[model samples]
Target: MHQTRLRITRILCMIMITALMVPLFSGCASKGNSDADKGQTAQPDTQQQEEKVEEKDPVTLKFPIWSTITEDLFTKLDLVNEYKKDHPNVTIELELLKDTEYENTLKIRNAANELPDIMPLKSAWLVNFKDNILPLDDLEAAKNNLFAADFKVNDQILGVPESQFNEFIWYHKSVFQEYGIEIPKTWEEFVNAAKKIKDGGKYIPIAMGGKDAWPDYPFNEFMPSLVAGDGDYWSAMATKDEPFAKGQPFYDAYVKIKELYDAKVMGPDPLGVGFDQSKLMFGSKQAAMIALGQWFGSDLKSMTDVDINDIGAFLLPVRDSADEPFNTVSMVDTFYTIPKTSKHPDEAKEFLNWFFSNAWYPKYMSEAGLQSTIKDVKIDLGTMFNGAFDVSNLKYVLNKGGNEDYKKIESTIKFDVKKMGQDMMAGKDFDKMMQDMNNSWKNARSKLK
Candidate 1:
């Protein structure tokens, strides 16, 4: 009976040991499962961290524009607001200035070292401000859409042009019809047409805003381009010692303009009015023609009681024969640039890329009524351009590239051709004016050498 009791005790001890061991095994299995779960969850957590890192930090960019950002163009397009949808982090601060005051303001800001991040620059001003502007040749936007005149500065690209403008004579079709003036094909014919309208005494032949110096540019700045039929006329003139002589392109063109003035073709006291007054005179049918570029189309379209269909444009006739091809001055009007002093150059570049892309470029061109500088983008400026758009009938005279020697001489001499046009209208002696210009130009060139 005692032996049987000892065997029972040993069995009981084995059962006790097995019961304690079960809890230890359960604890180990739970730990192994927990580690496996963590291994599976770690990859997704790492991916989430990477996604957070990819998010862009918020940024603001300053965009300085002249006359383009107001209630008319930029506001109508809602470009900035639309851009924000995709790049929610970027905010564009637009600084608008009147076209007349823009260049001076920009110069002031540049001197103060406070240029905006994005600047709309005229092509002629690029060479002057290149030191402060950043080179954009390597940017994808520059590479993709830049034209011959765009971004070129001392072999480095400093900006990209958005659109180009061609100089022309905008006319009222009804006035031309009433006067029996067919579109003039030659300079002489153009004069005759003007004379006919002027002799009528009821309307001004050619409405001129000579008070505003820039309104005279089509005749002063672009006439030589037509007379020479060469894109490099201005630069080539710089090489000549007597570029203002009788047979020279500059002299010949000015002589033609003087003849027009002598004929009393421009309205009485042409210099007495400004651009707005001239536009009104033409819009009211009191004037038959006005010399301007494609930009004037929008203004004409906006006039009260003015029919858009009644407005027409033709390339300024410089050639002698209807059979001969005429040359037109086509130039890059405005360019986009990033100033070296910008705090957000990368963001500026991003904005430019977005601007020139296929998505937004067409819409911008349509609203601005400008021809595209980008390759393969076609813009129809409608009837306002008229014969100006026909490539077969015309050759293009692009703005001449800058020369250091010419730039120096131009600055020192300060020969104002626009002022010369006003003087001609005011009955100044053409011969004396030409003589003075020749003397001044020679002296300036001699100083440069």
Candidate 2:
């Protein structure tokens, strides 16, 4: 009986051990499947995130033009790239060419109707090819800016206003101090200063390059302001059926230029000198000053002996007693335009939107001494103007409707000013020159009708 009992007990123990092993194996298999299911569930979210990243990336754009290869351009390009991050669909390709060559090539392309999709157009040419360019009139991006009034052509807007460059008289502070001559505040003061500097026998008062012909434009912009005064003088001259050359302002200005010329205020070979040489003449202390744009600040910074802080600037002095003391002519530095034959007009438009809306531009452009077009974009005036530019009062007046019909008034002025310049250069009979210019403009207006 005892042997039989031992046999049965051993069999029972073996059967119990087999049962435990089976359940343990089953538990292991169940745990493996749970892990596999979790991994399968996470895969879709990871894949979706990658797809979202790709969708948000920007596309590349190719811009064909040549500009100064400076730190400013590089900063602008970098800002463009940052703008693309939020708008991954747009990319920019910079095609830099020599200045003269680029201008020639663009003219050729324009004539052949093979112009690039986007181009930087000069404002002077904007009116000539109004049909070939896209009007930014209805562009939600451009309509709400100060430039809207300036960039309009007849009933259409032609281009985006990038920045304005103002011309000023660049004088060497050291030279002024050494000679003990004050910087002129009025037209008479300026002439007197020039005479005093000439008498000192140190250097000529002005360094001008007549060979280029472009320098003549500044003189044109400057002299008229002195006689006509800045406030709609051109318009008054234009509408009165008065001749540009015959006007008191023109006569006064011509007399001044003749005085400057006869007194030898400018260098002897002014006509033979080029723009760079003129600046160099001033930088090397051969000339006391040069009348040019704000860009001269950058040129002078490159010279070892010349400190930019030592270079002082002043507005062209005006003769009208009641007018503002400082008179200026505004110049558009760069204007943005889209060609009529662009394959990617929508893309270009979208990129401009991104550029203007992005905050990176203000930071980028300001770092390189450029102004931003975006209204909210505030510049540290201390840095940009370097305490030289103080047009705070003018800004206030413009905002307060100082000149409500300023545009129409300014157009007439531009025509007279340009004609006055050409006539003076040609030595035409001053009275006849003014009369012809006025009638010519009157005829131009009649044709516009």
Candidate 3:
């Protein structure tokens, strides 16, 4: 008994000694991380002593944004309350604006050299203001390593991409199934399907808001990809100095539009309606389907509460035979830039560096039905994103690189052709209308240097 007691007591003492020494050894190890420590280079993820050595009071930064994003996401205003377990000194000012007013208002501000410290500018607008914005490349931690090679021109890092957004043709699966309709695999099929839906005493097949030039994007810029047969042809059109209205591709596309309109496929009074009206048409089950971004997933579900299994999507089908239908548009989803006039450039950049890298940012975006530009993160596809389609913005653009010429068409031939389309829908002759569009483009292109 005495011998056993001695052995147990010895073991207990050793354990106690080990327990106390562990923390001491850990502290020493952290202090000894230099090369001399050899093999002790790695340390535990505990707070670094350097972080504690010189902590400054948190700096408040104002971030102006246009979206109707909730204040719950303003971490700076929350001051990392959940994370730091206390209020942060940084406060973000949230600025919301209607879509129409956002860009124009920013442009006005830009003219006066007044832009927000952090402003979410549309991608195309970024091209005009690239010089006024600060580049994120200089920050060591902020420099995105994954897509390092992608950073080009003027050292601009732009803003981190938020979500997978694709322009797609979506159909109501249940409605299609009830009508025994197959999803359209070609543009002709799409038009024919619309006619069938209309003949069945259903509302016209597609809804649109033509007043907003943006909604016209699909028909103007994207639909041409179908007629041009591939992206390369579209690119050629961009550099040709001849307007799109001069080409066979442009002619073929307008012909398709005429076919749909002649078939009475578009909702009656499409030009008279607004975006919400069209959205309501699809949401309230008045229209069969529409082409729009995947971000509409949340709104559609909210408006209808339809089962996830019932929502269906497919890329816009090609009109002519081709290797593959160009499935996406390569536009920048959205961007944020530091303006030259910002009062706190360095601070704003610091905040963005932390903001983009924050783990919560990705979750917040996913919850809000957005995709991130940052490459490392993956979506969990929670209740919201599950079965909600998304595609990589990068791949989407590259695939459409062959179709970039389509964009030039909108800037060049769009107004004239759309005017002609309006006349055609009013029962005008196709050839005369085509000739008018070609003449308009010829006149306009000659004005350019």
* TM-score, predicted candidate 3 vs. hidden true structure: 0.70
Give the number of colliding residue pairs in candidate 3. Answer: 15
Which of candidates 1 and 3 is the stronger one according to TM-score? 1
lDDT of 1 by residue, 275-363 (tens): 88988998888888999887777777667867788888888888777687777888786788999999999989999989888878888
Estimate the overall C-alpha local distance difference test score of candidate 3: 0.59
Error of 2 at 219 (Å): 2.0
Mind giving the per-residue lDDT tens digits that candidate 3 earns over 1-449?
99999999999999999999999999888777755555444342234554553365565555555644334344434434532333244556666677768878878888988778877765445545667776766754346533322433345665443344556676777778877897665677777777778888766577766545355456655556555644444545555544345456767676777776677666777777677788777776688877776566656755653565666776666444333444454333545567778888777776666666663566566655555556676655445333433322212432132222334444565554345555555667877776766576566556553
Off by over 4 Å in 1: 1-55, 68-71, 146-151, 387-393
Candidate 3: Cα lDDT at 127: 49
Better of 1 and 2 by TM-score: 1
Which residue ranges in model 2 land beyond 4 Å of their true spot? 1-60, 64-66, 69-72, 75-89, 97-107, 137-144, 154-156, 222-242, 248-255, 320-325, 357-359, 368-372, 381-449
The ten-residue window of minimal lDDT in model 1 covers 384-393
What is the C-alpha lDDT profile of model 2 across 278-351, one tens digit per residue?
87888887888787765555556656877666677766554434244455555555567787877778777776
Badly placed stretches (over 4 Å) of model 3 are 1-62, 69-87, 139-155, 225-238, 246-251, 304-309, 322-326, 380-448
Q: Which model scores highest in TM-score? A: 1
